[model samples]
Target: MKKKIRIYQSINTKIVLVIVLLLVFVLQLIGANFITQIENQLITSFQEDRKVQMDFLESTITSSLEIEESGEGSETSPEQEISSLLTEFSGSGITDLQVVNSELIVMGTSDTTQQSTVGQLSDDVDLRQAQITENSITRQVIDSITQNRRWKIVEPVFSSGEDSQFLGAILMESNIESVYDQISQITWIFLQSSAVAIILSLVLANMLSRALTKPIKEMQLQTREIAEGDYSGTLKVYGEDELGQLASLINDLSDDVAEAQESIDAERRRLDSVLTHMTDGVLATDRRGKIIIINEMAQSMLDIDQETATEKNLLSILDVEDDVTLRSILEKQDDILVNSRQNDIPIILRASFSLIQRESGFISGLVCVLHDVTEQERIEEERKQFVSNVSHELRTPLTSMRSYIEALADGAWQDPDLAPRFLEVTQNETDRMIRMIQDLLQLSRIDSGKSMLNLEIVDLTEMLDHVLNRFDMMIHSAEYEDKKYQINKEILEQSIFVEVDPDRMIQVLDNIMNNAIKYSPDGGTISGKMEKREDTVLISVRDEGMGIPKADINKIFSRFYRVDRARSRAMGGSGLGLAISKEVVEQHGGHIWADSTEGKGTTFYLSLPYFPYEEEEWE
Candidate 1:
């Protein structure tokens, strides 16, 4: 029977049933309480009315007894007065009025059979209140005769107010059965009305329940469709209640999810575009080392077809070069993008993955990406080779000059008088070649980013002084050197020291000064000066040279590049001074540039950031 019921089959029906049951239970409880109260009131009202009637009879009987004692009419006994009182008691809604004497005799009654019962005495009558009260009492009394039938009331009559005298008790009983019958009829009407009300409530409840559940049922079906991966369309809802609002939200959510999915699909396609046509290879892996996805490029790099690569472990498929930077990136963190090349073909690749967590944040899967860099590597290699070739070209001349100076020093300078003259000339030429070779080497290392600078504080004034002493005799002679630099003022004691690589910077300054001397027409004024700016120091070396043409200023720093090669070689120039100077200044985190105009002087200015080295290291 329980199995046949299908309790969960109809939600609306069940809810309606529950509502109707609860409403009916409460309504019935109220009706029962109402009926019980009304019945009690009816009984009390009927008994109270009967008590008044009995009191009237008692008063009349007591007055009559007084009259009898005074001899006003025919003097009657107590029993006779009671019997007359009972006989006179009359009302249509009442019946079976009777009276009894103190002796418990049936003196008289409205009906003869009831009078006979009166003589027997009513044991059910609550006589205690009457006995306690001087006047009258009223209460419900169960029928003394039939047991089921009820009576109204009875009252005892006293002889007089002053004297201790006994008078008969006047019992006036009314059936009140008709009032009870009327109440029964009304109760039947109430029951009928309650039945109608219950039926109506159940019907309304069922309708309400259906109205509530209809949209919910539709939404439930739609949700199942969504769960089953149906993104076809959306559900439309009616009305403006809570369920309608819920439907609107679901519709919006579905649209957003669909749009988001399309966007994701678009991104995947874009990624595929880059991966499929690229020359180099790419491979991706999951947290468990399984291949989650791979671009065609990656598949090609590993030398495996896509069909064969799916579900394979990444570590197994990848043919990564032993010393590639990608190995460090991949081994460092769990799921960040790392780059690597699988073979010597020089493929640049990026891989990214994540712990694919569910809503509860449990790790589930991983993802990765790839790229190619063979062309890039080739270009970089060409640049390095070009720089190396330039360095070798500059070194050969310096090497030849050094060998001549060595041979001249070994035997040619041994004759005492010729020694001083030959040694000085040889020393000057050797120094010039040594200076050129050292400048070329520095330029090569700086361009390759292979040189490390000693970032320390050095006195700029003292360094300049030491270099100045080497040229003191030339500056003082002024005849053969033909150049004289005048100290304009007392050189400022630059306690304003800067963080610099002094040796590298000296090489830079010396190159610029040599070029100035080499290119300047005879008897030209040359100048050197230093000034501090907001965050850097500027050193300027200027000469009134045969000024550069406008178009050629940009190319002056190109290697093995010279303006008027014959004139530069005649002045013992290596054509690498300005080029090397640029490299050294840039390596010191500084800038060097030339400003020249037609027939005007050229100024090479070098600027370096004022690095404060004395402050404590934050690291």
Candidate 2:
């Protein structure tokens, strides 16, 4: 946006003022010099005319004084003739005229107001000086009464002889104010002409300035319009001068800018599209770490709205300000695992930071790419846990078998009782390890989706009855003589046939029944049921034993997860039965879950797809 240019600040006004001032200064100097020379010439000419008149008056007065000195008589006395001559000699600019004798006595006077000074000693200093020195004297003075300028002249009259005698002196006073008045008039005329010249100069300067600044003003308007995204206007070139060349440049600049604008807009749209479709959340910040641009993915990942995220500090928005600072991130330029929660659900984000730097190596801001790593991190953690559990489980059995084998090898075989017992213990541990390894391999295959089920149609109720009969037989066997238990079966009259992998389905039921028997107390009844539910059949195994905690019930199906690790290990359970059962049931298009309460009992349910089948077709 262009600012409004004040009239006084405009280049046109400046040029006009500069030209006018230069003219004024030149005129002032010329006028002063012209007036001074005119005044000097006028005064010099006036003095020369006054000197001529005084010389004429002195010669005429000398003839009259000499005649008196020779005692010659005339029609009038010498004083009368001198007075007549003085009166005739006096003219304009002459204020007073006096004739004095050699003795400095006034002989004649022309001023009527000073006629009484005749025959009196002349008190005029110039008159007395002229008689004593026998030379003329002239001086100009201002009259105190009229405040007018006057010139006083005293000329000594000499007789015409080889030895001239100073007869007397003629004194004259002349008003010379007219000389200065004429000089003043001439100066005034010069001033009037200078003023007119200055007026003319001002007008010419304005015209010249307009010619020079017209194209410049147009260029200014054109540039302003270009800045406002209007590149249609072109500056009119007035001449082939500098301003015209500049106007041409401006026109070229507008064309270049229009092309650049289109290119920039296309690039911006492409960038916006890329940011919108990016799977990874991306955010950009200014040098101050304030969020400048945040894409939709970034907003979603951060769980922030566009309005709330704008201009907000990036670290604060990511909730990592306490642990990480912008400077640290910029300096390190490393990826940060940001542990955060959105809507109370814990999530992990891999925030990769990079510097937005210029070619000059100036760090302008930071760009952060946020990748939601919550599921990845969870899977990674589970992998680590699985490795550790497998190591520990293998280590326990291997360590036990190693101890028993070492005991037997170290002469324990000499004692038949000790050797057989150690051998038996070693074999049992080896079997446990083998079973664990098999379960681990099976789970790996299932997790990798490489396990295939041998699908078949099977009677869900008959499968449940077969699983219960085994548990019933185990309860009455000599091995469980001390631990009393009972089996309660609720089988539906109409058999529910489900499409399943028969072995896998039987294995799933075996895991449930075994868990029930292991956890049941003496005389505790293990209840089994088969029922058709919607288009599926549900088989539940209930145990009257201390149940799993509600918190850990959901996680009971995870590989190697045991609520009581010591008790489960002591009972020789591999802890993979339930995990395997879940995978098997799910693979056969069935679901398995457990319902439990602390200090109560647990019910494990398995639901498989059910279909009404005609047994005669198979027969």
Candidate 3:
């Protein structure tokens, strides 16, 4: 398992190992430096001790010369004493010692081997070439004089006496045994420390690897949980460090994942409900051209009579590409289209997409939906047709009336008897056409929703009185002929003020009153009455005239739609009277209706909201 992990993993282990190896290498370098220092010091000490011994021996030889010059035991054999002294000094780091004289003759030596003598008299050929003057020391590795198995350190020496005289030179040859011993100790120390350090470093490396890998291992586990769609918080945090920050970020990511999952679930449920209830069709597909899901409406639309469209091809079922908008939206990573089409129908559907990314941030899948809006489009078309028809009907009559009026003014008035009736007829025709035009203009304004009404408080009683007086002359003239022809009005209360457009209210009442007068069938009673209710005031104009049938009641207020077209045309109905009245009532935020029994009478009621309905206005 360990080998497998290393093979498939990144180089984290390698980096740590490299760092540890560098540490061990530096330690060994330090140890090597310490050993080198000890060796240099030892070598210097050995050389200095040898030089000191040579100096002491030279001083002893000089003392011997002085004793001889004083003539005290002058013949006591100087050679023997010098030889003994030199032999003793030979036991030191210097293996051999010799003294040479100025005569270049044989001098007392450290050994009686004759070849160990410093001068030529001893037959020591190598010793004769040794320097006699200019004191200097040098070391050489040559064959040892007494030992056949090793080499020696040969150091040359000179006396520091008069004439730099040849009191004789001192030569020392050191055995290589001590140098080998010192070198062996250093090598042993290097091996020992190297082994100990390697073992300790391995232990530390293992521990350090675990310390660093532990947090990352936890992170790997958390990442696996997230990948498996288990977003519950399980991140392990240690302390306030880089790794701690990573843990915090992971925990935050888990929370975000949970929230995202909830949002997706909610959106899914909402989408499902919408698909089930909506009259439109919905379809979803994946990135590789495979169908993911399809709603019932969509299935039915595409002639697919199954419970689902899962694992199918969308294009195979939905051969129609009329929904270009939805298709374009589905083509993007994420998009929304408000208007999409169907095969043979125009639809406005809202569609959106979400790109699915994998571990490497590559595209994975796609989703789509569709909707239908055919019925709503048909209804709107019908309304537009109706408006156009109404316009035509109103315009035709006005056009004809204007033609005759122009004709009558230009020549029909030339004949006196013909001219009087013609001009009167023309005036009435003009008046009728003007009323139609005025009604048309009002209806047009209402249809266009452009008419702004200036509303104010209106006293119903005062308004009625003012309207009654406008026809006072006609009322008074007909008093002698018939009392029934005169207008009659009744009021139940005073201070009947309401919020209304006064002029529009007057126009509505005028239209009703004119219709009453023109189509009363015969002399009849024209009566007006006001009734107060909890929230509104009702104004009624009743006349013994033709009554409207129940079947036409619903359409009575439609523009250019008249009941009893022949009688309405004879009575000079503009066909927009009730329509304009309806518009005016609605503008004041009120209502108007008619109540009557055919051939009995007609009563048009205008209901208005009290200016301050909530207030105790009745008081």
Over the stretch 1-619, how does candidate 1's per-residue lDDT look in tens digits? Answer: 1234365678887888888889888878988898898888987777777766666666676665455445565656655775666666766555666554444344556776555565575453444345445345554456656654557566665676787454445555566666688789878988898889889988899789988888887777677666565666576687888889999888887777778878988998898887777654555655466776777777665556777887676655554334333345345534332244445354544444334557986544444544444456556765685577456554655566566567676786677776677667656667767866676677668768788888777776666655545444454574645554432212446555666788777877677766776666666666777777778877777778788888988878876666676676557776677777777677777898888987887887888887544536522
State every prediction's TM-score relative to the real structure. 0.41, 0.81, 0.41
2 against 3, candidate with superior TM-score: 2
Clash list (residue pairs), candidate 3:
100-168
Residue 436 lDDT, candidate 2, scale 0-100: 90
By the lDDT metric, which is better: model 1 or model 3?
Answer: 3
Ranked by lDDT from best down, the candidates are 2, 3, 1
Per-model C-alpha lDDT, please?
0.66, 0.87, 0.66
User: What is the model-wide C-alpha lDDT for candidate 2?
Assistant: 0.87
Candidate 1, superposed: residue stretches over 4 Å from native: 1-26, 29-37, 64-81, 88-96, 102-106, 114-137, 160-164, 176-181, 240-245, 264-619
Segments in model 2 whose C-alpha atoms lie over 4 Å from true places: 65-75, 98-109, 117-140, 151-171, 283-293, 304-334, 342-344, 351-368, 411-420, 454-481, 484-506, 509-513, 516-555, 581-619
In candidate 1, position 317 carries an lDDT of: 55
